[model samples]
Target: MLFSSSSTSLSSEVSQVLSENIPSRSTTLTGDSTQFQINEDLGTEDLTNGLPKKLIQLKKLKNGGTTIKKAKTDLEYCYDSLRLYENPYVATSRDKKSGYSIELCLDNKYKTLMFCDLQLNTDFPVYYDSSLENVAENIERENVTPLQIRGKIRIHIDRDDQALLITSQSISLKCFTKEYACFVDSGTGENTSSSKIIKELNNTEFFESSSYPKQQLKVTHHSSSDQKILLARGTYDYPFTFTLQANTFPATFSSFFGKTHFRIESSTSIMRIPSKPKGFLKFSKNENITDKIILTEEIKVKRVLPSTNMLKFEMFQLRSYNAASDVVVSVIGNSKLIEIGIPFQMILSIVKKDPSVELHDASLAVAQRMAIPSIDLKTMDILPEPYIKKSEYLLRTVESQSFDSDKTVYGFCFDDVIIPNYADGLPSWFKTFYFEASSFYPNYAALKVTHLLLFRINYSKNEVIEGLEVRKTYRVTVNFPVFVGDSDISTSSLLPKYEKFENISDLQDEPPLYSTVTVEGDN
Candidate 1:
């Protein structure tokens, strides 16, 4: 008998199934005058299985390829856990002329990733086309689907030169709620005065466009085509409206009942601007972006500010490097991925820190927004911190300068992105590094450091022609410290306080460790 006096019909059915399935019969029963009764136990009652099944599915997903769901991730978990030749994954840069190689390592721990000493052969021809004729690049693999993870370790090759590059890829891991966002523009030109256009008590750093706090206008339709452009002659006034919804916190706090569980309610509002406001966004097809004239205007804040909440705003700009037509529009989100306009193969780079630069810790120095050029949505790259080692986070994309023989000339720039400092402000260990690279090591090159926030490099045209004639490669390295402020409500600094007593015997019944330990010696 498998049933006890308290057994229900459903339990009896399941018990009968289990009894028939097992090869050997083992039952807890006692004979009765009318029937047999089974003993009840809670341990044998649970029929749910979730853990083992998940592992089995993960194994089945692997199909003779570099499995993304393997026990370990291809990207290192921290900065210190990096390797090159010794590890299963290695990154190498090879010279086209001398056939020499340079090895770069990815450190997962310490947030510090770097390449060892790099020495390139001067005879190889360098390709300067931004189209990537022949340069060794790193691929990022962090978060992906089981199918994508189990697929082959894919490497992209330039059809012209057969040079291989690893693409950058990653996804958001944090949980965030999104809503219908409208009239979102980074603070730029006249958009700066439009803060009153949004009436919510809270403002996000990411506008509909630029991700830079200082940048304000979202450049929507930029055409290099020879079209009649709107010149920046005067400030123009316009009308705009926006609707917003915010997440609400619990009105009451009850720590005794549910310590960890808390619920939040959501509220929404609509804002309309009745007055004509002045702002500027110049439209000229001829002038390069740097030389374009800029106009500024101010708008009035309509809503009242509450003393409790802080209002923060940010702006960003996106442009295309290769084709004149392709443009990328991005908004910074509370989560990992920047809200990009397109969905396609992307080459991503996370601008973190330069380990080679001077600093206590280089990676933490630039935890601000990064500048990204407009790109086709169909062929985009997604790079985040988790996809690579901490040191690699600082690596970003740059437009190649020119192609001389097989050598490629590249131009690199850092964004003027900034994050707000907390009350405890910038940690002592934080630092930031600046770097500039050329086609090969050229003679008489100059680097300009401006505002402690910007950097520029000038090269002698004659020296570039002489030293960088053909296939060659070189990398410039820099480093800086990261700043972190401690917020009052920040969860990073909370711990329980415990008291220590002098005597063990005076206390109540002691634990084994307390009785066994003595100041002088323990036998």
Candidate 2:
């Protein structure tokens, strides 16, 4: 009986296995037990041949699932991580001629990294005409050209990756002009008529060219680094030499309606991953791609005046006092303006009606008015330093008198008076304040240094009683405006004229002859 039961179970299991193995045209169960139908158009070859058909189907599934793994990894490069020590760097014509320096840095960690190739691409505007006004019209007519200057630097990484190998780099500047013709049409076709009246209109045209001729200036490398320098993983500094030329203008300018712009761009060809070979058995080329990491910053070229040319001088009167007798005080020097750490000269002249009146003493005082204290807690309640509380003189001087009997003029001259460098303290209600630029006050128009001249007169008692003596004492004050700038002053002379005669007739060999003739007529 046990054998009989076992036989029945075995028979049922065999029947189920056969049903699963056989390919069904209508429906089939997947490994997840999801049922789906097969397309009748695919044909029923597997349905007729059961076991072999199942083997074929499994082989096809295995082949479809197979994938070939990539052999070479993709190299990653990031331009956004690049940093420049100076951006929008300015290089004047003098600077460019003398050469300039720039610093750059890169932050990256990669094992398969190679060398970096740095390139500087410069573009300078070249106009056909010297006039800037016609630049728009010339541009619209496609008459403007661009002059290019290129420079390069290569950096190779060491095997240990500790430092980079650099080559000497240089910047070369060249200026040139281009000529082109522009045509403009002025006639309007709105007045076309059937009975055509052909009228010739006047046409006007002019030729234009650069004011200065073509010129070239070269600046050598001034970098301390050798031809092959080993730079570390940090910032790399490069210096270049520049030479100034006669025709050189400011680095960037707009003139005659046209503009000349100068720009420097840095680019690198490195940090790119090599591509794998075509076939499975093939290897990667390991060759560096031309792909480059271009920096976003573009350095600007400009021009700056030398320190010697920065100083300027001008003459302006301070004040005049009219009393019992006219007393005029004027300051004479290289300039009325004063700066810190610079010495200047000043002269005080006093004239009086009575030559007999002797000069006792004379002094010059510099002072400013104190600002009103605000209702703030810190300032209004507490008293501050002596310098803050009172409007004291920043500088004071007593001058000796020199009487000129011939001119009846008493004069005092002070030389090399230096302005002390003082900290510009904070503003409060009780302290005098000066702004970096200019400051305005409500009641008092503006804040400035006040110069006071105190003079004492020694006169006879009888002379004092006379109206000629304006007063026992005289005070003449003036507002002295000060500025901070260069001390050196620059002057220019007109170009000398040369004698030239295009024709002998224009030279006038001798003065024209004049003769007098009288005509008598009978009345």
Candidate 3:
């Protein structure tokens, strides 16, 4: 849910917090079964009693098969939601436009957004404690100014539908989220598993993890100046705008158990007004037709946090024994951003050597930790701590490598290693490796995933502290936090640079102390 700038000084401010809740759906369709017969498309099926089925077919036909043809829109999107900072295509399936209907367009297109970068300066702050101001304060719902999104909609009524009139239009940014602890079966079609929660929670029994609506902006309405004009319309164009109060809208993800999402909805109501009999009471009452065109567009939101650890030239070092002397390990890349399909460098050098110390086989690996933050059952807000699940993958290993404290000045750089993108399937693996665009996105309130680069040093040393000489074997580890993001969006001007080094004593900076970094862990 949060990210830090590299150093302690930079990360002192607040961090990003996930928005509270997102609804399962933006709009629901409901109606009474009034048997009627009609034909528009789909080979003329019965017009009554099959509303849901009818809508599905209409959506495919109207939106051209559930996707937007790129030729029609300026926005570009990624096919998968795994990578960060790419526009995501949500539902573009529009209802069939016919008879009396309204079309709502955002920035001129009805495309749903999956990820959007929120630039935070003093303007947008991300908040962690929410007590005092911090770097995250810009995006904090309680602190920052509301963000405005504008769009235009056109209402059209057929010439024959003379009584249909545009009454009022409503626009709102709907931010809501929900979680369900079920009966352990995803297909159960049930939300909360009350029996399970009660059994698991035995401490005086307070259960059910669901949050209330965290942040919301008032619904906005735009109405035509007067209603005296003929209820029917040739065409009406009205531009509407919505302001988003919650800046940290998490990327939308839904499963049987939980959901985090955001959407914008616009509703236009139209009703048929009965006209009094004109030339002398010819006829009486007519069935008044009332309809509302509600349009919902889901959007993805992301917060970009910068860190020096990801820079190529921003070198970081970890000494085996002491901050002042002894063996050292160095990585050529920044600590923050470790990317897949890209390689980084790691080096080992004995800055100072003695016959008492010996270096053996060494290996580098990556550890992945997915932290599903704990939620308060009562408030539904995310707690500070998380329930972390971990898995490890081997990056590269060295069976034998020689390093002399006096001879190896530049240190021994290992073979480049990468985060795998091709090992796509485990349950199903093909003879050939297939590529998947799915890699863990950096941080999310609902599900936060993080990685670490681990350098495991295997060595033996002889010590004579006591009266007798003793030989000892030891495994020392050096780890670095890995933040995932696209390389194009990196804040570092250039990659880490290096200068010629002839001797160990010629190094400029003092030895590095221990580094304490964790995903969403701020100091």
Candidate 4:
């Protein structure tokens, strides 16, 4: 108050936003706490009280944990705001019931996309971009067609309650249905009505004098949680047919059911099935959070299983704030010891190497000397030899099939080198060695270098299958920098000894020419 303790506030913006009106202070209750208990307006039926209860009728055996029941009459499922979504799973030929699987993926807009049926054609390229229509249209045409007269009917619990709730407000009719003629009187030109068909085919005579009800369908939703409210309001149609017999039809009637005259059938039955809730609600026992929340917890962990006799090692390069650091590790199998080291090179001397020692045997001997559990000659080690010597590293044996050109060309392959752990401190006789391989197609100035080298041994059937059957081939490329000033003789006076291709500087903007070297082997 400009002058009293009871009230004194003045703000033009607040006054205008609040209707610029004054309240009667005389009517306020000074001590009453009712004003603080205002309920929030969530715009949906507040399930804060819990889901509407289901009336218990008859209970049957449970399938898994779900209970099944026969509706006293036809059922329907109606929602306030319904949204249909689907996700795809891998398609396999072994699925007998469904015959196929629809692969569903989410689009950028978070819409669920599914491919009903797809068949890979020979003309399909090895790689192609996938757009929504490209694959869907092609696959649907190639593998599936509309059931000229078929429809699907399903019952769903609108709310999260495991029990179905019978609510007149939410229950509605025929989400989907179809009607097909069973018989037609050609001379009379009258479509056999549902009542007529029932009379003619009542072999059991159960419906001899019964009249079906006009309200043939209804649907409802049960609240799954306080937040998962019932929503969606819409109608759907489906194709349906009554059972028939060949003898009941006249001799001239259409042979196929589709050819006969028929009217859309309308009857209501509860679409009762397993209760599944799709809403923004989760149980207390569920560990997952809303997708809108940022994930900070480690979601995945990989365990290292002990190798079954094969020698092993591991290596990694960790990134730091300032720079990248290298690490090496090795495992001594017999002793069950680990070693780590830093980058160090070893120059392997041919003099110390025994000429009689076979290459495969030599590698195994080296591994055994280091107390490695086991060594396979054909397996390639992923750890670089130099790092293992001083960096104290772990090693893992990798298969040749996993080798890539980048790994080989980027000095990723390494020889077996051993390092000791520092249980108490560094070793007393600490020394490191390094070895760098000579480049391929090398030569020396003022001299000719030996360029020929060849070696071959046993080949396995698996290798032939991978090489010849698939016709796998890879390209090897080399890039080197060149510097030149204007000169008429467009060539280096004495180019680097191994200039295998024409210099690109002369072509300016033209595409570079290439030469191929074909290797042949007699079958």
- Least accurate 10 contiguous residues by lDDT in model 2: 111-120
- CA deviation > 4 Å runs, candidate 3: 1-101, 108-147, 158-163, 179-214, 222-233, 244-259, 272-288, 306-313, 321-332, 339-345, 350-361, 372-385, 399-451, 458-474, 487-523
lDDT of each: 0.19, 0.28, 0.40, 0.19
Give one digit per residue, the lDDT tens place, for model 2 in 1-523: 1122122232221111111121211112121221112213222112122221111111111112111112111332111111122222222111121122222221211101111110111131111111222222222111112122232322322222222222223332322222111112223477743221211111212111221112223332322133333233233333322222211222322222122333232322222111222421231233322222222213223221122322235544454554645455555556544544456677766666555544444555434332121212222221121111133343445533444444556566677665554443312221111211011112221111122222233322123354564445445555453333211111111112334679877866754311111112211
Q: Tens digit of lDDT per residue, candidate 1, span 70-129?
A: 132122211101111211222322233311222222222211111111111124311111
lDDT per residue as tens, model 3, 307-349? 3222333455655553323445555443444555456666665
- RMSD of every prediction: 34.1, 33.4, 19.7, 34.1
**All candidates: TM-score:** 0.15, 0.26, 0.48, 0.14
Q: Comparing 2 and 4 by lDDT, which wins? A: 2
Worst 10 residues of 4 by lDDT: 292-301
Question: Which candidate gets the maximum TM-score versus the true structure?
Answer: 3
> Looking at model 3, how many pairs of residues clash?
23
Q: What is the lDDT of residue 322 in candidate 2?
A: 46
Top model number, lDDT: 3
User: In model 2, where do residues sit more than 4 Å from their true spots?
Assistant: 1-311, 368-407, 420-471, 484-523
